[model samples]
Target chain A: MGIHIGVDLGGTNVRAAVVLENGTVERLLQEKTEPEQGAEFTIQKIIHMVENLAEGRTIEGIGIGAPGPLDPHRGVILNPPNLPGWDEVAIVDQIKAHFSVDVQLTNDANVAALAEARYGNGRGFSSVFYITVSTGVGGGLVLDGKVFNGAQGYAGEIGNMILNPNGYHYSNLNKGSLESYASGTAIGKRAYELYGIKGGSEEVFDRLKNGDEQAQRVVDDAIEYLAMGIANLTHILNPEVFVIGGGVMNAGDLVWVPLKERIKKYLYPELVPMMNLKPSALSGDAGVIGASLLTRK
Target chain B: MGIHIGVDLGGTNVRAAVVLENGTVERLLQEKTEPEQGAEFTIQKIIHMVENLAEGRTIEGIGIGAPGPLDPHRGVILNPPNLPGWDEVAIVDQIKAHFSVDVQLTNDANVAALAEARYGNGRGFSSVFYITVSTGVGGGLVLDGKVFNGAQGYAGEIGNMILNPNGYHYSNLNKGSLESYASGTAIGKRAYELYGIKGGSEEVFDRLKNGDEQAQRVVDDAIEYLAMGIANLTHILNPEVFVIGGGVMNAGDLVWVPLKERIKKYLYPELVPMMNLKPSALSGDAGVIGASLLTRK
Candidate 1:
């Protein structure tokens, strides 16, 4: 067995880890991304982190999980809003040049999907759809342990999935998009707009946890739209299971209980009993862990 | 080197065909399903059809394309409204008892998808999403020439996909479902309700063909909902190609021209350029041809 290195490059932080075959971390390191300095600076930072984590171990392969709008097939990081000023960065090529083994790249959502399907809650299922309702509602479909990135690498871009044609306008996403209704950012904005609660999603969840009727109403509305998105996905893909993660999901029972109940209303009667959904086990570590496992393929 | 028989057991008729390796029908026969007579009677008729088509040749395998709610894995035809009183009939077991080879079964939408992906317009695409806009809107996902029947064999049940929470209801499907808005049956019903156009979808198309403004508006509303469904599918699966077929598509340019133009507005900028959608090449023959091809696996 050879050493596998995983790099998760986010806007604020870049994490690197030397992961074991069974998803165990031998060593891990983190550094400020400072992406505004440019793609080259971030690439150097990633390389330094990897070198330190490896400590001269003969590396088998390296995998990276980055923000979307990037090309997984080409291994290029396009100008995603998260990675500002980093236009057309050939991340894989740069990393591959430094490493002796192969380099692979995929979006953050896909990385989590792979992690969940292989090493976490979605482990036993043949098909696993991983949905992260964080700042935005992104999803990844993992089939037989590989990410189904679709024709243009846009397969799991479910954030822009239109739920209501005239619902809400969030950034450049479609009006009434799922992200606009269910995402953490959306929840925070919704809380402020509806009840003038400036505290955001955390505050809303806290209020709901404390048994506030107003918070329940707001959450019910969000859950309703979220259920529609999941149901649309279910009717379309019928994957074995759905593993939901991200900051929004951390609301715990406030979201999970209502979500589980809401989703049932949309599924076929026969499917109701077999609707397999679970929370992500890997949590924040999924990005790096899934990246490391990508080398196995 | 072997002979394959395909049986398309519909509510109205049962068509059996001896299909070549290249999806060509060597010989075909048809008879009234007489499902009302009972599943047992229909089974005898199917066996008779297959026996006649085989003509004492060494039979290889048999495949069936039927309406859904059937268990594809167990080869059981559940109580679908189309096949009245055929509840949990072990069609495969019964057919296998009469034949010396394996018997395959799947929903009609899946069979069409398999046919389109392997022998028709979707040929050459790695993943094909085939949508049949007939009396009802149903779809199938074919990945790498194989049908992805999903967990409970409900994959590609796009007809039930919820487009609007408060939209139209067709049978027991989700309110505001794609089928309720875009299917031929839906079009006819909507046309009749809005303009008292008793001539059904044909009249709507004919009127729209002659530049009827009212027909144009009705078609536009339906197209808008249909566009949402397609856009949702595009973002969710991002398959290589989409092959659309069925009675509604036969309306030709009336639906196709508007559908193509409308769908663009809902897709991502990158996907807009690479949207590989086409008319189903096999058309009405997809069910029979796809059923036959199923035996190959």
Candidate 2:
């Protein structure tokens, strides 16, 4: 049986892995995208990492999961915020030129949702919403076991949905979006605003863990907003379960416990009993796993 | 050829009709859903209307679209706010027993999305988010020509996604859901609070059409919030188009023109050019048409 290749192309790194049919990582390779060197160079870097991972083995197909606002149907990265100087690059054709294989591409969040649907927290559900709480919040939606690609192939971009209306500004996706409050940057900003200090997100989280008063306030505020965002998802999509992944989840119980409580507090009373709030089962490897399954069909 | 029977069960009335494959309605029948009669009796009323609409024709399947929180998988209606006493009614079973046809049930909003996808504004799009800015905002999501029933069969309920953080004292869905700021109820409440009067939601839209200062402020505030909400959707789903419906949209260009402009202002700089925002194509018959299509399969 031929193995599939999953490539996760991020601004700082290009991670490639050979995935078996059962969703296991068989072989892995990593390198830098070096996007500052221009689109062609980044494309070449992606090819190099994939080639290195393949090592002359027979390959089924390839899937690349990248940052958002890109055209998933066309496999073009349209000026993602994290990867600068790469705008409207025909990534699919460029990759095809380097390797003779079928290829699929999607925003990273959508890929993550796919991973959850097939192998992680969302496996048993027909509709799933996956959220990654890392440097910034990102999300993807899976409806009936297939990625719910919107008219523009951007259906599950949940982070930008506004969460707060009284903030510095308004984002159409969500006001006071999950990003505005749950993302690391937002947490840091809130920490600084609350404590008048720099490099405090980690410190405040640590303090909250250790029972520090001021830190608890900042962390509590973030959790409140995060829970509110989750509750928004609960009210809007009513997904079976919300899979929360990404680096911030390292805060563990600090995040999940309060987030679940607040979401329950705010969800429609009828829906509150049916809602499921859970952490992402696949964490670090979600991107690779989701990307690998990208070529399943 | 066998046709499908659809029943649009609403708080005020029940409309039943037989729909042909090409999206035509025949033998349409309408009657009030008298709540004083209780839940079991209401189900009987619906069954009677559907049988009357079916007349002598052989119907293959039956579909019912009701005020939601319906367990699409279980075919139960879980006490939606609009229709009281509809607590976990096994609507699909009741209809099936009465007509001896396959029966399906979903929220009115979800079926509306299906209707838009199959026979209305949502045609030609792989995914569509159908939202009604009416008495209480409700929504539906259709992906790849199918309604997206979440894990628990509740998805595309965007109306309750909170917009305000501190302005409204609401329940679990969102303290300041879109309904709090932009729904017909919210519009009237805000107008009443601002202008100190009372009347139909249409009256406020009429006053705005006539350029009443206070009414415009109230309406404008609502519109701005709505635009902000759309922006949030753009950020999250990046949908190709938003097919808006409901009583509020009857304001026509007076509402959509400015609303679209404001939404663009909030989109990511690169994505603003790719978005398409439009008024809903189906009107009074949306619920019925959507309900009809729900039984198509």
Candidate 3:
């Protein structure tokens, strides 16, 4: 088999890596995506990055992980807010035209899920639900090493999962959604509304580390909703393992210890003992690595 | 090919049937379970039923659907409230001693899910999530025509899914759990508490048919929570279809019409147009039919 090329195309940057058959990434490239320049420009830049990374080698297949609101089955990008001007851009078709290799596309969270299931914290588990709690909450499910994208490619859209019908209303998301209360943005907003603190989650965490009481309350409240969200997922899907990542999780022990303790309250008593929650091990590389692994399926 | 036997073991009675390879039931037998007589008596009773149903023909396999917390992997029953005095019954092994055919065990909900996936409203869908809003809410997931039991066999435990932390407290379920707010029992209890209507869901529905305002409010609130639960499941799983059953749905248009309308408010706009929620078709026979299907894998 020839080299598998993984592409992580984000609004800010596009990355490509030549991955070995065993899921190792060697040669890599990174360039500005400049999505404002339009889908054609970004698509051409991605092709340039992939070509440069492959270095004349016979390319086996290419996989790209981008923002959602796209059709994976038809390889069409349906105007995701993050990718301005990409109104139904056929990314896969464009890439396929330039190179005689199979091209596939999926949301970023799904790509990360596949990577974690194959070679990260989710390794060895038969089923894994990967969650990202960064700017907005997102998720993906990998069953038996295959990404289980739901009927409309919107399966892992957990950020919009309503937790409190009367809770906060964030943009178009449902009121009291997990993302509205537990995401980094949510934490920062709550902190500002409560204390007029100008900084975001980073500033709030710093204050918590300094033993600030208000910050402690805010952190505790965020973890509480996050815990509820996880408990809901556990009851609904019961995946073998949950591999979580994102800016909120980066708070490390502050979020982890409380998260593990709080989820137990929502789970059935029997499930509390054997719950398998692990921090994602691949870190930021999951996007590119997961993209490459998608070609294997 | 040999014949397959399915056993549905409930608190009040036991049902056995000879199911054709195409998921059709040609003959069935029903008898009192009398589980209070203890595990040995019930095991022997099941053996006699199987033997009678098989009529000395070559038995290909046997499958049993019973109340849960049963261990499907080990074929053990772990003291379900429905099967009292059954602290730990090695059901599969006990049945296997009298017959040489393969034996399998799974929860009643899971068996029903398999039945609906193969022969009812969920047929032809690659993934189906089945929900029963009876005295207590429960659920099961069938993916690619196979029961997608979660890691510890708690997958589809939607009864305990938390929707409102400050909502309601029903039995041992989480406060504001889906079951606490939306199950048939919940509807009856709410009716009794608010308007002294004492006949449970059946009475409430009867009153609502007369256009009782209190009854309408009770029904509407229950449907609201149920809609939230469905929306949550949709955002997380996005299965191809949802097959719903149980006594509450028997209210027909009174429940179905508002439920279809309420769930739309919580879902993403695009998803509203394609939500495929259907009433379960097989009814009471699903248990035996689905149990027989367990052996096909």
Report chain B TM per candidate. Answer: 0.98, 0.95, 0.98
Q: lDDT by residue for model 1 over B1-297, one digit each (tens)?
A: 679988999999999999999889999999999899999999999999999999999889999999998889999998898998888999999999988688999999999999999989999999999999888999999999899998889999999888777788889899988999998888889989988999888888888889999888888888888888889888888899999998888878888888988889888877788988899998567778999888796
Report how large a share of the reference interface contacts model 3 reproduces: 0.78
Candidate 2's DockQ is: 0.62
Clashing pairs in 3: none
Show pairs that collide, candidate 1: none
| C-alpha lDDT (0 to 100) for residue B174 of candidate 2 | 64
Q: Is candidate 1 or candidate 2 better by lDDT?
A: 1
lDDT tens string, model 1, A1-297? 668988898999999998888888788898899999999999998988988887877889999999988888899998888998989999999988887579999999999999999999999999999999888899999999999989878899999888778688898787788998988888889888888988888888889889988788888888889999999898888899999999888888878988999899898988899989899999578888999988886
Q: For model 1, what is the error of residue B68's alpha carbon versus the real structure, in angstroms, after optimal superposition?
A: 0.7
The DockQ-derived docking category for candidate 3 is high
DockQ for each of the predicted structures, in order?
Answer: 0.79, 0.62, 0.85
Interface RMSD of each: 0.9, 2.7, 0.7
DockQ of the two-chain complex in candidate 1: 0.79
Clashes of 1: 0
